[model samples]
Target: MVDADQTFVIVGGGLAGAKAAETLRAEGFSGRVILICDERDHPYERPPLSKGYLLGKEQRESVFVHEPAWYAQNDIELHLGQTVVAIDRAAKTVHYGDDGTHVRYDKLLLATGAEPRRLDIPGTDLAGVHHLRRLAHAERLKNVLTHLGRDNGHLVVAGAGWIGLEVAAAAREYGAEVTVVEPSPTPLHGVLGPELGQLFAELHREHGVRFHFGARLTEIVGQDGMVLAARTDDGEEHPCHDVLAAIGAAPRVALAESAGLELADRALGGGIVVDEHLRTSDPDIHAAGDVAAFPHELFGTRMRVEHWANALNGGPAAARSMLGRDVVYDRVPYFFSDQYDLGMEYSGWAPPGSYDQVVIRGDAGKREFIAFWVKEGRVLAGMNVNVWDVTDPIQRLIRTRAQVDTEALADPHVPLADLLP
Candidate 1:
């Protein structure tokens, strides 16, 4: 257990950071707990930013991880709108902005989340061009969407990932003409493979969302400081009133990099390297959330996951490790997404392009199916799309790593629980 007098500092006020602070308090650490956030708002969740909140189905207050009163009640100090400029590892302190405010910590947790990758092309600074990562960004996008609905505007989304697709669905729902441009042959091809990707493509197409597959964004054109059109490398220009560059996000590793922490391999996207216990090279400092690349004993590889579940669970694991508890942080990685009429739940780890075969149960055409990625008859990963109440069984199959006949696995008549040993 940590000493009662040593302060524990948490950087980044997103879900992970907030959970870490909660864990520290729950673990009976009576010392000071300081959570530094760059945003003025209290710590909040991000998934709602692109879904319910953006669609007007949820209110602003629902997005926060905790009500403001909870922090004060828990005796957790919150330093909002503050940027940590540098980490003085030797002095065990973090320097804030130019004003010279600093905080000392006996144990520090870095949950610095990722930021959306900005488009480098021309006209990206136009008024109608946006990237959604923070609540402020979503608020701006929602306002633009509201006006676009009245004007019968067109929106061009430059990417086909989860954010891009979900935004496309929401935009379509808002009565905007929507077009999605993707460099890949199919949307979500890298993670869900082409078959499932095609299902998503079909789903969007049926909803009047146009697509430009195998097309790369060349430039965004603007008129009077507002987006008017988007040009692709395929020589096609899509006229639009708004553009969302949902290409991807890069981990915010500036603090870890500046502190001279060991980074993972460049091939693995270069996040702060951590051991099984989530401790970085410097034992006093630990990394979690999107910025941590830790070894996965199940997959026999080091990976960094940017999904919500990873951050949700990893925070407490890192806190346990900080308090000198025996923890491995080996839980099977899980993530879920909601797009259009489909709800998906995926579990276990199967790096892109590693699975040998994909076996499907139920009808893919009916949009209700569970797809499992197997390698040499051993289940590696599984995803249930539009299917409910099977995540536990799917994860159990992955955890056991049992060999099974593909025919029995694909037969919906056979119970998933019956296959488990």
Candidate 2:
């Protein structure tokens, strides 16, 4: 057990940071714990911000990770609306907030998370221009969608990534006219590849979502600081009262960067460089969640996963490591998404060029399929769309590293468990 005088400082208020504090307490670490959050709200999960919360289906209280009283009860020093301005690596202290409150620590965790990438083009400052990364943003969007629905106005989403597509679905459900502009030919081109990407396109099209493929938003034409329409590179203009920038997110690594922590290269998904144990170059510091680019033991490469599961699992793993436990945070990356009536869970990494073939088990046309990315006859990743109760078997296939027969893998009659070696 650690001495009570020792202190651990965590510089984030997301799932990862909150879970780390819980883990530290559960592990019997009788030490001071400090959690710094830039946002005023309690530590919260972000998935609902773009999903159920935006749809107005989930309660506002459901977003928070813990009750307001939980922090004080747990003896956690929670600092809300306080941003860590600088990290003094040599001094082992952090300067935060407007008044520059100082906090020293024996160990530090950078779970700074990520921020939504903003549109670099013009007219983004207008009213009705939205981005969904925080609960406050979700609240604003919920109201915007309601107004758009009532006014019979339009919402143009810029990007075909998960955020863009999910927000599109929510907007449509609210009775707002929706249009998506993407630079890629298909939605989620970088993630699901062309085959599965087209499936999403058809799914949205069936639900009245217009797609502007192979084009990107260049300008948001507005008047009196309110969005009017958006223009694409193809010179086609989409008239809309509101705009949502769902392009992507950049890791919040400024604190880590300023502290001279080594960062992963941009091509490898830039973030603070960490080992399998989540320790940074400084050894006394660690990073988790979206801001940690660590070596993936299974894939033999560095990866920075920005999913809810990563934050959920990574925080506890980092907390264990901080407690000097032999922890290897190699839980296969996992994440789930809900759009309209479709629910999908993806496991493992299978980016483009990493897999040679995508084998489908169920009917792709029906959208009840499990698609596997295979290379050298081994499963690289698996995604189940509208399928139930197969996450275990799917992840098992990825972990076994066993060569699989394509025919049997694609055969629904052949049990996924039977294919396991």
Candidate 3:
């Protein structure tokens, strides 16, 4: 049991940060826990923003992770709208500009999430352009969609990843004309490969969403400080009232870097570097969530995944390590995205060029299916759309490294449980 009044400082107010605070209390660490969140509003559910929230189906109040009363009951000091500008590692303190307050942590957990990548092209600073990383961004986009009434207004969504597609789906549901522009030969080609990319592109195109493939965005054309159109490398101009840049996200490592801590090996690629226990070079300070680059147990590679599940699970793992408990942060990477009427779930580490065969289940035309990515007659990774049960058994196989027959996987009638060894 911890002392009744021990001070612990946590940076960032996203899922990872919030979970760390809750877990500490639940673990009997009844201390003075301070949560530093830059956003003015309290921590809320982010995934819903692009789906139900934008559709006006889910209320803002419903999305709050914990109630204000819960925070009070747990004795949590939530410093909303406060930013931790710098970390004085030598002094073991975090300096904040809000009230010139310095927080000293016995062990600090950096869950300082990520920010949406913005286009540096011309007219990007226009009034109608936005990136959906925070609740405020979603709220503003929602207001615009509501005001515009969908029919006359046009929305140009750059990138064809989960975020871009979800945003496009929401806009189309509202009756707005939506056009998705991707420079890749196929949508999500960089991540899902061309075949899976074609499946995703087809899903969107079938929903009345226009596609601009193999087209590079040269500039965002605008006038009087408002976006008007997006010009492509092929010299084709596409008109739009609003633009959503969902290209990708970058880790918030400025504070970590400034403290002279060893940053991740993302100088050329992406993510912050961390050991198996999720600790940075400076053992006193630990990093987790989307910002930290964690080493994979099975794949034997360093990677960074920006997913909600990982953020929730990684924060406490890092915190435990900070408290001197040795734990290896290893789990099959999993993520899900909801677009239109699809609930897509993907599980396991999809190392580049690891899978040699794909066992597809159900009909793609019906949009209800599961696709098993197999390597050497073993299930390496699995994706399900409208099929939640597939993830459970596949996750089990991944956890145990179970070998299975590829023919069983390809057979639609064969249950996932039967393939488990």
Candidate 4:
């Protein structure tokens, strides 16, 4: 157990960091807790930045993980807008930017999160081009959407991932013509499989959003530093006033790399490698959130998840592990997204190329369905689209790994709980 006098330092001021600080206090760690955040804003929920906050459905204050006063009240020191330049593991000190401020820590948690991957196509630096990762980025895009609402502007989206699709839905809601270009045959095919991904494609099509599947963005044509069009490798030009690239995200592993922490396999996308308990190569340090590539107890494989739920749960789990408490970060992975009128919640993990068959309940055409990914008669993962109050059952089904009858699973009349052992 950590001594009450030793200081604990947390890096990154995102949801994971804030949650870790909260966990430390709640776990009765009376030692000093310092949260270092690169962003000036207090820790906040990022999901709304793309959906609610950008669309003006939610206020900025509502996005914060904790009110600013809560940090002071909790006695957690905030080092906002300061970058930790390096970690001297031998000296047990975290060096800040060139000004030479350093903080000593008995235990350190890295929750640096991930950054949106940048597109390398020509004109990516244009004024009307943007990437959604932070609240500031969302604010800027919201302004662009507002302007597009006034002028009936066109938007060219370079990806059809979650961010891309959600932003497309928001742009269409704002009366902008949206064209999403994806090299994949269907949106979210990499994660949800072609069938379910195609459902999303059809949903967007119903909302009047155009799509260019099996297409690559060759260039972003611009004039006066403002995006004017997106040209595809297939020799097609899509006229537009704004462009959003939501290709994916890469974990912020530079700090851990510089500190010489072991990295996960390159095939796993190379994050800070950790054990099931979230302990890094250095026992005194731990990693959580998107930056942590740890062995998943459920999947029995090394994996790193970039969703909000993982960070929300993993933060506290890592804190407990840091406190030398016997802990295992074994919660089943879960995530949800909202696009247009469709809301979806997915539970369990089914990595790419895994899960042989998809069994569906309800009507896909009606946009209300629960789809399960089954492998060898065992449920690996399940997603409920526009279906309410079924997440717990779906998650239980996944957790149980029970052999399910495909016919019963496909029947809406068959209750989900009946399939559980």
Candidate 5:
């Protein structure tokens, strides 16, 4: 049995940290659990921020991980609106809050998460500039969308990544004119890769969302502290009321970095290094969620995943590891996104050039299809667009790494289960 006197400190207020605390208590560890959140609100799931909540489809309360009373009822100490300034690794303590109160930790979990990568351009400080990462930002954006719709305003979104596209879809659904600026030739170039980028580009374009491919927002021009237009490097000025900077996010590693924890290289997306068990350089210290760069034995790579699924599973896995349980955090990478009428679920990692072939099953034009990234006759990744009930088979194929016949893979008649080893 675990010592009741031991205290575990979790420095984050997201799904991962909250779920970790819940797991710790459920596992019968009657120890002190301290959850420190930089945000004033209770721990919440982030997926709804960009999708349902931003579209006003979900209530504000729906985004939260648990009810406000759940923490108190479970004897979990929640330090809301508090920041951990530094960590004394030698002393095994964390200095937090403005007063720098030191809290001793028997085991520490760093789930600091990631921050939105802001635009470093003129007029980004304008009143109409928006970035969606937090609940507050989504609330503000929701109001902005409502106001824009009522006034027939135009929203110029920089980058065609998941956030940008999702918000663009929301803006369009709200009756606002939308234009997306992306440096790549197609939307989601970095993620979907070249094979399926055009599919998304066309999907957005079909919904009246204009695409400015092969371009990037160079500057945001405004008058009287409000956005007027966005200038792209391709010598085009798009007149708009607001600019949404959905470029990307940077992993929050300051706390772990200051504590001298080993971090992954910038090339690997730069996160605090954790072994298969989610243990950092210090065995007692663990990291999960967007802040952790963990090795995957299946993929034979170290990666940091910034998605809802990662936090949902990573937290519980880390909690078990913290309890000295045998664990190998090698679950296949997965993520999902909803935009307009299309819902997509992606499994596994297949970066550009990693897969030799891109196979499509079913109708791409109808947007109900499964696209698989296959290399060496084995599936590396699969994306189901507007398709459901096949995630298990898709993940199984990726997990088993079984060599699949191309003819059967592209055939809708063949059941995915038959492809499994």
Candidate 6:
């Protein structure tokens, strides 16, 4: 058990930071824990911001990870609206703001997370152009959607990743004419393979979503401080009322780098380097969640996975490691995205061409299917669209590394449960 007087400072109060603090208390740490958040509001779950929250299906309070009373009852000190500008590694302390208030820590955890990558195109600063990253961003987007009077205006979402698609789906549900622009030949080409991405492209196209594949956005045209249109490199100008950039995110590691902690080149994954224990170069300081770039057991390479599951699992793993527990933080990374009428569940690791054989289960025509990514008779990864129950058994098969009969596995009538050990 940790002494009540001991100080533990957690930087960045997102899902990762909040979960880490909760796990520490649950693990018998009764120390003085301080959660420092640059935002005024407490920690909240971000996944819904693109789907339910933006669609007004969920209340703002409902999105918060925990209520204010829970923190008070747990004796967790939440320092909201406070920024930790620098880390004083020599004194084992962290400095905040221009006034320079400093606090010493016995152990520190950095879960600074990531920020939305902005478009470098001209007219990006226009009033109608937006980038969703924080609660404030979502709130502003909500206001914009409300102002546009749902279903009447056009919303141009740049990028084809999960973030872009989810927002496009939300805007569509609000009755807005939604168009998704991507430089890639297929949407989600980075996450899902080209075959699967093409399938998704067909899915969206059927639902009235215009796809601008291989089209590069050259400029964001605006008038009177409001975005008016997006001009492509091909010189095709598409009129839009509001523009949202969902290109992806970058790690917020300024504090870590300024503290003299070693950093990997941004060209190489661009995340804070950490060992299996999630410890940085400094023994007292650690990193976790999206900002953490650690070694992957399956690929035998260093990479950073920015997903909701990483934030949920990595934070506690780092906290447990900090508490002197022997733990090797390795789990088959899993994530999901809700876009339009599709609910996608994915598991395991997939490097480019990681799977030599693709065994598809269920019927894609029915709009409920599972695609199994296999290599050397081993399940490398799988994606289930609008079929959550099927992935449960596939996940089990992936976890156990069971040899599946390719013929039997592909049989839709056989059911995924029969393929599991």
Best by lDDT: 2
Clashing pairs in 3: 264-273, 272-293
TM-scores, one per candidate: 0.98, 0.99, 0.95, 0.98, 0.99, 0.95
Task: List, residue by residue over 1-421, the lDDT tens digit for candidate 2.
Answer: 4689999999999999999999999999989999999999999999999998889889999999999999999999999999999999899999999998999999999999999999999998998799999998999999999998898989999999999999999999999999999999999989989979999999999999999998989999999998889999989999999999999999998899989999999766799999999999998999999999989888898999999999999999999999999999898989999999999999989988989999999999988999999999999999999999999999999999999999999999999999999
* Cα RMSD, each candidate: 1.1, 0.8, 1.8, 1.1, 0.9, 1.8
By summed lDDT, the worst window of 10 consecutive residues in model 6 runs over 142-151
Stretch of 10 with least lDDT, candidate 2? 263-272
Of models 1 and 3, which has the larger lDDT?
1
| Candidate 1 worst ten-residue window by lDDT | 263-272
lDDT of 1 by residue, 120-182 (tens): 888888888889999999999898888777789999999999999999998888888899999
Q: Which residue pairs clash in candidate 6? A: 151-175
What is the overall TM-score of model 1 with all chains considered together?
A: 0.98
Candidate 2 at 265: error in angstroms? 1.0
lDDT of 5 at 261: 92
Instruction: Please give, for residues 78-185, the per-residue lDDT of candidate 5 as tens digits.
Output: 999999999898888988999989899999999999999998887888999999999999999999999898899999999899999999999999989999999999
The per-model lDDT (C-alpha) reads 0.90, 0.94, 0.81, 0.91, 0.93, 0.85
Q: Give residue 16's error in model 2 in angstroms.
A: 0.2
* Candidate 4 residue pairs in clash (backbone atoms < 3 Å): none
Mark the regions of model 3 whose C-alpha exceeds 4 Å error after superposition: 1-5, 267-269
Residues 337-356, model 3: lDDT tens digits: 88888888989866447788
Weakest 10 consecutive residues of candidate 4 by summed lDDT: 294-303
How many collisions per candidate? 0, 0, 2, 0, 0, 1
Model 3's number of clashes is 2
